[model samples]
Target: MKRIALLMVLALSLYSCDTDDDGPNLNFTIAEITGTDLPEYFEIGESYDLEVTYELPNACHQFSNFSVNPYVDEETDSTFVIEIAALISYDANITDCTEEGELTDSRTIRDLRVSSEDYNNYQFKLLTGEDENGEAEFLIIDVPVGEPEPETPEENTNA
Candidate 1:
């Protein structure tokens, strides 16, 4: 009788050990940033629009929010380096999603003013994920000072 009781307990425990594997597998791809209306050269004290794009493994992965951190370094009096880091998050939801998904967003950079006396160029580094495991992309842009408007020739009023 004791042997039968032990066998029954073992069987019940084994049956209770079954776990559900219906949770969604969430993963993300590298995020990217691109200039939308920016020209080859950026004028001092001007605003420009930028576009940010990212993707998820599947539709089951929902976007929560994202944040970007910018770092600036002065390589020289005429050159500067800027690094932008992105932190993307997603919701852990279990759903039936088979198709891959993408997310696109926009941001504006206002008044790109430089205080350097001889500013000429800028190098941008865009990155995503943590410092330990992340990817970095680069973009180089030239900075040209706006041309001064020419003064119209005054008509000879004494003619």
Candidate 2:
């Protein structure tokens, strides 16, 4: 009887020790912002492709990617406000990220301002809904400014 009790205690101790497969928990890590290669500024009418990428948990192997096109019209006032729209998708197997209960279909943030002086900076923000694990999260990304454009050039007959 004592041997059986010892074996039971040993089994319980071993089970308690096995805690590696906790399955990605609420903790998350965000990676630095990443995206397409492009210039910082675009001509008034010209459209540019903008993509912003980041990691989940803010410090883990899993990542959350965001893609969008944010543009300002030179013809219009440079101090206009614009919205950053992105299509967010997720991997079902993602284990170590904090998200809302379910993957958000589409997220539209309101009142993102783009002041004229801010042209030198690119801002990226994330909005997360509930995943299987209940938690809210976000990531902020700043895109480095590229080289400045030359003064407006006029058409010349020398060409």
Candidate 3:
């Protein structure tokens, strides 16, 4: 019983040790996709690079990554929700963080092969902001997609 009590004390002592606090406090937010440079049309079974532009809220907010989420509203939708995922580091000394400007950030969605065979277009919903009812408002863009080119057969008559 004494050995058990000693082990409990050791575990408590180890848990009370101080941890290093060298990193800043981080918070995350989903920024709006203000601009996009996409092709006029997309071909099925083809891959393309998409460029999105957005601005950070302030100096403390750093561009971390792009959040590309897919949504399906119906049977024919190949919808995607695109936004900028930012890391907001809270520092008491930084005060000039509210200036919003056009800062172009580049990200590539490589090899985007839509699996739906019947989708006629690609829908992108950009989260513009929240409404007065606290619901998300989106800037919807629908880009038409062309049918995939038919594959040609080889000119060999081998059975």
Q: Which predicted model would earn the best TM-score?
A: 3
| C-alpha TM-scores of all predictions | 0.45, 0.26, 0.63
> Which candidate has the highest lDDT of all?
3
Ranking by lDDT: 3, 1, 2
Off by over 4 Å in 1: 1-37, 60-74, 93-118, 128-159
- Runs with alpha carbons beyond 4 Å of true place in candidate 3: 1-16, 19-22, 75-104, 114-116, 147-159
Error of 3 at 69 (Å): 2.0
Clashing pairs in 3: 58-97, 59-97
| Superior candidate under lDDT, 1 versus 3 | 3
Clashes of each: 0, 15, 2
Candidate 1 lDDT by residue in tens digits, 1-159: 999999999999999998865665465444444433445566666655554444444444444443444344544555666554333444446445565655555444455555554556655555533354453444444434444457899999998
- lDDT for residue 12 in candidate 1, whole number 0-100: 100
The better candidate by TM-score, 2 or 3, is 3
Q: After superposition, how far is residue 58 of candidate 1 from its true place, in Å?
A: 3.7
Q: Give the winner by lDDT: 1 or 2.
A: 1
- How many Å off is the CA of 117 in candidate 3? 3.3
lDDT of 3 by residue, 40-137 (tens): 77777777777666655554566676666765655545544333332223455455666465454545556666555566677777666678998877
lDDT of 3: 0.63
